[model samples]
Target: EIESIANHYGWQIIEQEIDKDHIHILIRYSPKWSILEIVRLLKQLTTYRMWQKHEVYLCRHFWKERTFWSDGYFSCSIGNVSKEIIQKYIQEQGR
Candidate 1:
């Protein structure tokens, strides 16, 4: 469902994985998009989709506030960086 909204807006997901309590998605798009905007779109649209599945979590957490994700998200530049290098960097973060 998240993919639907993203793809609709022309955002491409390069990789994705789910951990116990969170999700990690590697995305790519043209230079016109901003990481913050993409993250906002993901959380908002995904929250909408989650309701359809009768699932709700951090939406109500005191600390989650209005963001399904934290106030900040991890992002990096793909410019001049190989996919292998990017993958290794994200992997080494131990996420």
Candidate 2:
């Protein structure tokens, strides 16, 4: 679902992982897109899709109305390091 959404928005996801509480993604996006824009769009789409498919489960676990991800997110520029290194780091996040 996330990959599809990223593709739809023209973002290339190098690596991703979803743990029980959070997700980690390494992506390459166009210069026209800001970090906040990418994060916001991803969160919005994922929240809507998850709610559509798992409303009952989400409500039971989250106990909140229309909430999937947290209000805050962490993002950083991926310069000064190889993409492979970043991809490996993100892929190993849940382990």
RMSD of each: 3.6, 1.2
- Which digits, one per residue and each the tens of the lDDT, describe model 2 over residues 1-95? 88999999999988899888888899889999999999999999989999999988888888847888889999998879888898888888888
**Model 2: ten consecutive residues of lowest lDDT:** 60-69
Give the number of the best model, judged by TM-score: 2
Residue lDDT tens for model 1, 18-93: 6666666778787798888888888888766665554355445633344444556777777798977766655555
lDDT of 1: 0.70
Q: What is the lDDT, from 0 to 100, of the residue 75 in candidate 1?
A: 71
Over all chains combined, what TM-score does candidate 1 have? Answer: 0.68
The local distance difference test score of each candidate is 0.70, 0.89
Q: Which model scores highest in lDDT?
A: 2
User: Which residue pairs in candidate 1 have backbone atoms (N, alpha carbon, C) closer than 3 angstroms, thus clashing?
Assistant: none
Which TM-score value belongs to model 2?
0.91
Give the total clashing residue pairs for model 2: 0
